[model samples]
Target: MKVINLFALLFLLGCVVSCSQPESGITNESIAIIPLPDSYELKPGTFYITGQSSIGIDTSDAEMAALANYFNEKISDATGFSLPVGNSGTIVFQLGDYKELGEEGYRLSVLADKLVLNAYKHHGIFNGIQSVLQLLPAEIKSKEIQAHTTWSINCVEITDTPQFAWRGLMLDVSRHFFTKQEVKRFIDQMAEYKYNVFHWHLTDDQGWRLEVKSLPRLTSVGAWRAARVGNWWEREPQLPTDSLSYGGYYTAEDIREIVEYAQQRYVTIVPEIDIPGHSMAALSAYPEISCTGGPFQVNVGNTFYTKTENSLCAGNERTFEMLDSVFTEVTRLFPSPYIHIGGDECYKGFWEKCPKCKMRMQKEHLKNTEELQSYFVKRVADMIRKKGKQVIGWDEILEGGLAPEAIVMSWRGVKGGIEAAKQGHSVIMTPTDHCYLDFYQGDPIVEPNTYSMLRLQGCYKYQLVPDSVDASLIMGGQGNLWTESVPHYRQVEYMVWPRALAISETLWSDAQSRNWKFFVHRVEQQFRRFDLSGVNYARSIYDPIILPHLDKENRLKIELQTEVEGLNLFYTFDNTIPDVYSNTYTDTLTVPKNASMLRVAAYKGQKQAGRLIDITIEDLKKRAMEPKK
Candidate 1:
């Protein structure tokens, strides 16, 4: 038997192979990614193997270079391979478009002499990498390496692409500014999960995070705020020492770079500029645009549900002109097909009382405040379409009248998406119940802070398409991370991973071909990916937190929350064989994970679920270690 030197090899390849479906459910064989034209071919090799990238070396950005090198080293270390000297003898894996099937199609084909890695774009490359990680042996997957060989696979054909045209992740940067590098790091993580869209919440009541050439103060004044004394969630008294300088916006060049990087990965960045509502950030810098024309600070409180005075007046031509200029600059910066106009939770109390708003509503003959919001959305949608772009907004966009070209994102639930699709408009699913990552995965009593209801398995088992809806109007789905509470990068990583892996499988895998047992095994393999990569993940406490509620049928039901690709769920009364049809959950599941015969399920999408977890009472006792006081 050959001894596996995983440490050295894994460190070289920069990834650790964890688990694989062995013939008898246990074996130690090193699985190496053999580059094929359309897919990866598994080879049982004894020598050390390393994955090399064409990305040139840079010294100035040592952290970036180190990250790349670390990946290379880990893969090699796990496989017991030595780094090639002077780039000679390194397997030259050529990256190209492997569109043998269609968009998002990929394949690893092995011809006579070398390996070829091909995909539609960078995101495909990311997916291919995850797939390669799956083929590795289990010991390598679970933070250990094993030795065995005789890897083989029947030549198979795969026609794969994202389930939803828009698989996205939203990040709210207005509340807290993350460096450009931090943003890029987040993008890297998103790509790893095969999420193809990045919804950037760039502006909010806390601060403005984009620079408009015409609106100088937007960055100069609006972006900078007096030092925030306390957490927005906590009602601590403002400290006198609270100073007036606490933020920065992205420069056009910065955005251009970010856009290019995302483009390389086939990820579109949808930037949101709140209109009519969430305008405090803008009004803070340009007081002239406000009907009151008084100095305003970045709204520190949750005034959205309570106040009505901040609404942009439709009667004011300057309001339209300002929006025109902002949209013009925004359109020029982001070439995405759909621009997001936040239309959720706008308090109409201000519009009802404002002279400019009342007069304008009368002039336009709008029936009510809802119609006015619809009008505002349509006006922006019109401007966006004039520049040749579509528009997407929250469920609130459906309130007044959805523009023909506007796509509705059903964050509230499938009702909006179903309604919008029935109306012939495309819809992206982002129902907060399943896709909000900011929620606590474990019991709130155990791990307090997050407001979302998401857990690892919940993220894994999620289906972007509701069962009753027609498939034609479904554009795709996305996960949102509204960082009212997440203040650091590590927190972001903790909430996203494993779950994002589930999402990847969900988005990429075919709906009909899922097996829960296989998915659990796959996630088991991915644990090595997270452990070696230093990604801190939420624990299994989440299972009991959502399971008790899911086990019963109620008006409010539970849905499998996952974004992993290629997952399947299995359940059994006897626990012998999994019934895919009867066990599937469309709403809140009332079933228990530890029931007489609860079994693992498969997720068939680009999203991935975490491990096969059995929740114990002890699970509820665990808490996320808080930062030092």
Candidate 2:
């Protein structure tokens, strides 16, 4: 074995200290084959980076100066190209011409020791910077301290690009409010992870978070609400006394600014205007839309209100007129090609009891409640398509027969996507089991216990393609962060990162290029990045679980070895977080009532490590955690 230098190794160790690792070394080849170091010597010159003319810079923009200063610092730290006042360095990067290079836009080439990073857009440049950051040492990327003079390049040539057209993260701003700066910070994180789509859930039952100039009440009355009492489904009903209160929405200007910023990072902001269901916020603003026209108030404190009979307002030309106007403003605000018309869990009990709905069903010769949902969805889809946009909805949109030219977001599972795909419709696979970011990764007790079934490893191991199906039907995948309990920016970041990073690589990196070991290394590196950026990610306790190897007879066992202190193992074959004091290690764990998936978590004092096991257990305790469910 080669004897490594002590101080350098110690420094590197410090860099990776807090990011505890699996004692067993990484076995993946991609991670095992890092280029050996040749030399660390300093000799460089001037470097220049430019953007497309649309950016309009002439060495006068302060941000340009800042960008230059940042690169200057990086060069000094990594390649020892320190210059005094007027020394023009040997390296120069001319950045410009921002445009989408299809899917293969990311490219970097070193010609005669001069590194050139090129993309059609500034966002491409940002992605290039992220790749370069990965190439450097963890210490260098973290910049614990910038190097004075010591840099060398050994002829590196790289042409990088994303595999999927859409690598996205959806943040539901309706249940929670994030400040403008906070939204930008999330964008920064997205860019860091090479994510290119930001699915902004702008409205829901809890709040209408976007400002509509035509209707001030969208922000004034609809946006405000009384403090929530408890779980939305189980809160005690307070009397319908007059109490108006709480929260704010994004003004149109605020949204424009946000969109522009995200555009700079090459992230398309797709606004989700929940409809059919999750429309209480909108209904509250316009009582005329409700079947019951009088005294309809926002359902504050999680009280589920009966749907008003005025749902589609059949024959009420006025209702269609209102929707036309509403969507007009919506389309103007969000330029994305596809708009989300939330069509899940509508609880059409009100429709079942409404006279207008009954009459419409009779006149239209519709069969049942599902048909009404289909009718409502199809009309909205028709309306949106007329406005030069396509409509996307939850898998439920597939229930009443899908709308023509509609994209199916398969949240329920791969079945919906598979059905839609076979029909030749585009499908975004966000199966709640593997793509919902809100679900606890491990034992329910350890995580917030989001009703989702996806774990980190499960997410990493998921294949977007359905078995024996055409790959062309797949549009990509998204990890959704639905905020029922999460209320702040810190909580948002905590729930998104690390796990989302895993999804990022799974989506962006080449499938053959993937190595779990390299991914873990990069994850540890990201922890350092998060620390420097002041992001509130979860502790190391909730790591990806490594299953014990099984022998020929299917017997499983492995030595429980770790150097960390105060560690404890608590597991449940059934999905639940194990209590530290509860010494419950049994052969079988029963699936708790109403539970759909099994999970477990490990923890030490104040440090919790849990991951949702992607194992489907019919008998509660007899299933093994598998790579895929």
Candidate 3:
């Protein structure tokens, strides 16, 4: 691809355009940047990138040169200029030892003539580059070279750094496989919001999505599963007649490619092998490692607990050997200092019944199955530690006894996180209520089918560091996107965004600096950018919050509210689609005697801001009778 020069192209425009005033009601506060930066001062003149603009970096330093090239390629798409790293360019990336700004901190000075980004390390420079991109128009994200785009950046003095080091997002690929390209896109989005950790949930009971050379059947058998798609945990069970042909795994080459790609963005790839429990797929491949694991098929999302086994038998020596083989390959494949060993929801029922488990318990002087689970985790932790990688797992690993040198990823709630932090272990506080992106962020009636609700408001308001615990022990938090309900890449974008943005902000920005109203406004601005980039995002929070309540007269009444203010909720009892011209909801509604259904929608100005939602009177009655959330 030929690199376009920015200077010649801008010179063709005949004059330098350097308007510093906020154009068309756009202000500093309205900038749609996710994970908002700490401090910035808007200047009088704008920095219009011209063909003469070049990225200045220490060409002798390979890493700095690479970082400059990354920014060069990004701007080249829109600016029509493949900026080179020379002695001194208008855009400069200077690396130095500025300890006060921290390793991931940067100070940027943008003027009409030049933009200089100074940082203490490579990551800081990279972060400054992202802020610059955000300051520009959204067209910079276009894959194709845009012909008529004005690549103008706001002139400003800015200093920013992350509040937490472990800003991350986890994707569970076992439930629904995503291609390598899709995974790369996911990582790119994470890096956009300054998330540094890519937690790859590689193995689960439903399927295994990683390859181990020594364990051939792990992918050949465990990675493939019978196809079943519906609401997760409600799909049909895999029968003997079912053929396992609807799954895929990442090859060693694919893993390397993704790791290298993530490295370019300063993102770490943390591979997770959910073990002991969620290992039915593995047992399906090697049944001897399980107690009663003969003829176990990869789960088809059907309910299974009493009939089949998922946990690896703690008593089996082959289990450790197989794990060693798996982790040896995993450690070699990923350069991350940490590996996730999922120990959540392990069923110990089979352990109580199996003779081998009892014998192993006696040999180790274990008190109960909980201790047995702990022993399994400790052994796995040791295995991972020997490979020079620390082990991080779900908070369930804290049961009976905490493993040595292990980090706890608290998913159940803050209770487990507090427990882990008090014990002097580093903790990642990703409580389910705040950080589970897979859950429904809107009403199920209007949103895609998914269980539970973790609203964008709830996520944005999450207090990550508990006051009672040692704040230093808190290694920061991340959002987990379990792929149970998310089946494809497009839907993945729909489920993650807006909410993931909330998580990113919570993890990156300080609690005191965050304001809910301001963040929502910024999110609305981001939605416009997403629209420009053709990225899917949920606007369901703007939809009316339909609630069924009983009046004093024992009649079912409907109440509606919206997460966003200024949205006009219009409703109709006659079941016609509601629009702005329809009856406005000023008060609670009484369901008409013969009305079959009620439809509601929210509007801003003349445009439909939220999706239309229909609720049958019968469903409303049923909801009224149910317990309040």
Candidate 4:
């Protein structure tokens, strides 16, 4: 045993205080794996993980070796031992021919004496180990060694094969740049959920996050902007005298390191150098590429619509020259099969007005600005394909015509994806209503302010493949965390989790086996793991959904419902805060005759489980005027 220092002692005390409180009342008898396995069977016994246990694997395989080491590192906090690999061990990992199970599929059997894991590829091993981690007690994720505790998993046989190939999460680093370490932490959590892709939105109107070594200004100028913390599009514009110290960019070495880090977890980092539209950062760096050249600053959240500098000058030869340089450098850094060229929201009015654009359109025999955009997209696609890569764009890429061999990321809605699939183009569906994580997942009054609401149920309930489209053309969907309002990493975690878990299951687990009630139970299990892991997660599901409405007499009436079953909603109309002792909501009720306000809260048993919603009677009337479904 090692001597415990003061710092370690305090940390253990903190973890102990938290670990004492388990997250849910759900029974441990069931195996609760998120993005639930394709099939599993509960057996009669349990496999206990003790100090004597060792992790077995073929160390000769570098991937397995790293995975084994990672697994050991993670569990070491609780077990207090480095389990040797490829030796006598209770846990064993083996890779063999499992074509039926697919590349990321695995088979695991945990018995009394020993546990065996079999997978065809390293990615399968990576995913299999995550399930193993979940099997252990939540305390196993603690930062300190757990003494007098049994780190055991139930005896079971699990066969998991993802139904979708592109299980992914897109982190928009452009709106708010997360540090390289933070990005790694995000990927680590995504990998644990069996997500195979990390779509990195590297550049947008707000900032450029990746360095193009040849085009130094892309970082020196484009990657920075004046700080503004109010509403995203309502912030005051950046002034010339303001200090541009709010942003940062990833260097070439940093990009390489992050990419390799993701690769180790079997995650492909798809870089999105968003262009044509959302190109204000690039335009700010090199104003020569815009229709109205010179004097363009990196956007400061305020809408710069019709300014015409937000989009790249599609007709300029210099724009292609700049893009070629950036694309060449991008291809050099990332080895992903596809690169995202943002062709969404490009204001064509500027293209229609520019002399260079008119000349190019005439030369190319194009009719409208949409065809001009198509020409630019086709050209950009050709440039990328020449570098041995495919192009991916927002649904707007379908605007004149989608480039040949291009992948469409349908952000507007499924309509675009369906159209793309019908046109024989691959589509990654990230429709804003369901897949946009940046939207408020809970009641916006208490949740972070955002444009829309995408509740966990809404995301989980969505059918990924629209029956109208050819299923083969639909790759998968991702939860896009566009961070205009998420200013830090913890907020990022809070926004992503629980909801992102819903996305993972929708994309990986077989649709037939997906159960909403059971999935909520699994989410509760994950909450405990996150608690022990020091990861931030939202408790919004426990919050009551408050809906204001007009009575037959046009009186103020409100309805409150909890998403998680059994969470009691308490309300008070007398201007006092509500607790567990307050009046419970059983049915619809109108505001009191002279009550000035209504305060509602949610509680699990005697403990507060959600944010308190306070609404003035006047505000309730306003909400009732525009009732939400």
Candidate 5:
């Protein structure tokens, strides 16, 4: 070892003191906290929650007192122990002048006898309380009181802060309506991970999920679609005997309840009202506003018809009138400073052919249909700004030219986000490859059929902020769970978790501090918590991704690798199920002659760890030849 100078030794000792490893009992391997805190030091001992303990808050501050009461209620519901509100107690929350803590950052200290939380804002205090809950037994998340459960927390000091201001999860409810209670539960889970934004995709081609009082037909006609089962993209058209009602929308009162619930958890709901394109539901309610003036019905299927006319009539003044009426009610219901006017996938072919559209193009001296979309987006942005709110749109809003005051939600890819940042507009990075939870996360044979592949590690490994873009303009990132294939809340939970947990840490924790192995360990901890809370989560991380390549002799060879280590992979060239006794995967194996299919599975010791993956030999060869995305 090299000798160190006295000053160097002192600096090293200081680092060791400030950044010590977590104590054994505090950072339990069985229950790791998601979105790991900025700085934490676990001390010996624990803070036991007894019947005598009470929650303390400043009664003068109504907001703080309410938050404290909320925590008390949750604890009481969980552990069968009621914590009364008092001026002094073992668990204390206080607002202090900690300017450095920021709005959503807090300092939490747990001593042997007392647990103290200090923050400058109520949002920070709420977040600190979430951390306290996580520190307790996983049973604390149970709705019913648990018998013989120890309500205690490890003694630790945590000064936690988020890396980004905006950490979000978008739930697309238009395709399949989720109940108000489900939405609240979603928000509650998101809050535990420090996600502050809930991007509600309330409108889409299939259905409209938000009610506009002025536009009665929106809910009356657009909210109900023909019931379709099986694959969403391959569903058959509705017959006369089929049920024409299979959807629901949130009433004004329902919106208020959900919004207030989110506010208490410090989650801002950004409601998305897709326009121009994906307007089939809207046009079904008011067909005169479309380029093709005829009757239309809410779409029950997921196929995007290229020849069909679904976009709004860009040239019609009636289109703007209808939009203004709808938006007027939307702005009143949602208090978010930024309103998402979906500017994505608007097929402009109808506008290119319509007489009114051509006339408007001539009047405005617009070159192409792309410019018409830009015009529509800019007009909507202006209207929304006039209502004291800014506009956020899909990356396509930059097709012809971006509005001067528009924010971009880059979903197609990071390129749009980069361009938006370059153009001096803020961007939220939600590229599909990393953030789209609807994509198939495991072996296509094992998981439900969806679009593309996005492994859990792929999400954890994403670099949200591109180096070329202005980092300041990069607001944050979000994961979107489109529900075309997910008809139930259980499937939604299955697709979002683990992956959402990865995205949460990506947005909240420092990028340099990320370690795949460490994160997976934490994920396993969350799995146990999810089990206790009756939440579904995917465990596809244990599955191995098969990669095929041709050897020097032109013989096809297959390679397999797991995301994490220690899992043994087994394979069979025949159409037989793989077991512990099957051929162990080590080096690349030659494609056996006369073998039509290959099956593979992973095992931890003697138990099967992941779903069995089966692939046809022809498909394997094609995959080998295709370039990786």
Candidate 6:
């Protein structure tokens, strides 16, 4: 009886020791922070938040105090617990002498007794606070107070910093306007991921979305366009009898509010006033500024209105004067040092036909319409410089000759970015192949109809700085969300997330730190947070991509692939919806001679995991014969 009791006691003690130890296998993911920290060390134990827990910040700094209050409010809103702000608390934020941490870097230590954040600047502290928030339970993201939720963080030490200074996301509001509240929500989500730049594409052919006080017509007339239905690219042109109103714009007050909101979140708003090209909306309001003198209407369709002469007239002095007035107001409204004057795809055909343009080109000794475009861009750059701001334009600004001080936003591809960097100009890499969030991320049949494909893995594998260019000239990278087909804010969220998450990690974490499998796991964790916050995100990573290729005998073959593992891909050649019991895909499939169509689906265990993909034999043949994009 004595021996039996001793053995039982030893077994109980062993169970206690095992329970106290940290979860087996320590990794950066043990903390589960997205855009994983530069370095981290997980320790045994957890930091518990009790009713008496408080937040401490440097009381001497006004900004720090404000940030502390902001975090306190967030915590209170989340857990229904009021965390008082004082000089001493369980959680402490202190300014440190760690100059090596840089302006946006922080050191976070989550001890069993207390949580401490150390940084040299307010930006770093803000980031450190974000890390702390991420460490909390996913229930903390809920807007409503979570009841009986355990607010605890695993003890860990993290030293974090962004790999690139410019981690950005561009939102094209011209295509589909989002309200001020929605914009704020978008910024709030971005801030959680440590994104620092918000490139606001404020103008496009579809509509002009920013208000210029001196140019009232820009918002009143340019902001609205005829409403269209169905596919954006297939929509009919606006007729005179059509109701020419289906959009909105931000007033000066609205702009000021949004700017303040973004500033509070440490996001710089870079406003893009697309020029020369994509000026149909602006020209509709002020027709005299275009090369073709006519009454123009803001485009409602997604198709490029190139034939309509949307380019601003370089020869017209009124064009310059109007631009100057617009820029004057824009510069005052936005505090960002760089203004994007879009110089992309400007159809110079009208310039070639215009007598005034020809005469101006002759007087300026310009060789071609491209040179004329360069002349216009240089002049615009000069105007921006006068306002103590720099100018950034699409890669087309490099045509003929780039403006001496203009920055290049390379959207076409990395070639454009490399060329700009070689010419001693700063470049922001946003090639469509990787950074365009509007592209279909999953199988086209399973995802919203978009022009191209950009897998999440492709985005995570992006290299911002090519080997040929100097790293200093590369300002960083951004993901562009062109909302041509996205009509609602929910759809925008679906398109932006997951892929945007990949871009965030790519821009913040070191390249060598990337592991697609591990990143997918982190994304799954974030998905829970999104669910709690009621944010829309896509789970198309499980969808299989059907790759059509020709065999050695010229027979068409279909290859199935998925970015994530453990998903069972099932297919049928008879065009029937696949189920768990369907034929499982183990290797490349040969096109059956009598097969008219193919249908594929993904499943996890007994449940359907992704959308059904349907493809015809003719479609496969056409895809196989098509030239490589």
Candidate 1, 48-157: lDDT as tens digits: 23333233323354433433343344345455343332222322222354554455555543222332334554445445544443433333443233344212222222
Give the alpha carbon lDDT tens digit for every residue of 95-180 in model 3: 88788888788998999889999999999998887777667753443435455565676677878888899999999999989999
RMSD of each: 10.4, 9.4, 4.2, 4.4, 7.8, 7.9
Candidate with more favorable, higher TM-score: 3 or 5 = 3
Global lDDT of each model?
0.60, 0.61, 0.83, 0.83, 0.83, 0.83
Pairs of residues at least 3 apart in sequence or in different chains that clash in candidate 5: none
Residue-pair clashes per prediction, in order, are: 117, 33, 6, 0, 0, 0
Q: What is the per-residue lDDT of model 5 for residues 417-529, given as tens digits with 9 covering 90 to 100? A: 99899889999999998999999998777888897999998889888899877788989999999998899999999999889989998998878767677677767767766
Put down candidate 4 lDDT per residue, 411-523, tens digits, no spaces. 88799999999999999998988899998988878888897888999889878899888999989989999899999999999999889999999999888776777678778
Give me the overall lDDT of model 2: 0.61
- How far in Å is the alpha carbon of 272 misplaced in model 5? 0.7
Q: Residue 114 CA error for candidate 3 (Å)? A: 0.9
How much is the lDDT of residue 508 in candidate 1? 61
Better of 1 and 5 by lDDT: 5
Candidate 4 global TM-score = 0.94
Model 1 residue 138 CA deviation in Å: 11
User: Candidate 2, which ten residues in sequence have the lowest lDDT sum?
Assistant: 1-10
**TM-score of every model versus the real structure:** 0.72, 0.74, 0.94, 0.94, 0.92, 0.93
* Model 2 lDDT per residue over 1-629, tens place: 11111111111211111111222343321221111111111223322221110122235545433444444443343333433311123333335553444333545553443555666544555565555444443344434343432232233444456667778899998877778877877876676567888998888877889887877887787787766645545655435664656567888898888888786556788888777777677777887765556455555545555633214344234556777777888899887887888888776777777677788788878899789788888888999999999998988898878899899889887998899989889888888777787876654445663554455566676677788767877888888999876767888877887678777866775665555555555565556645654568875334334334344665443222221233555554445555565433333333445555544445656455444334444322232334434
Stretches off by above 4 angstroms in model 3 are 1-28, 138-149
Candidate 5's displacement at residue 173, Å, is 1.1
Worst 10 residues of 4 by lDDT: 12-21
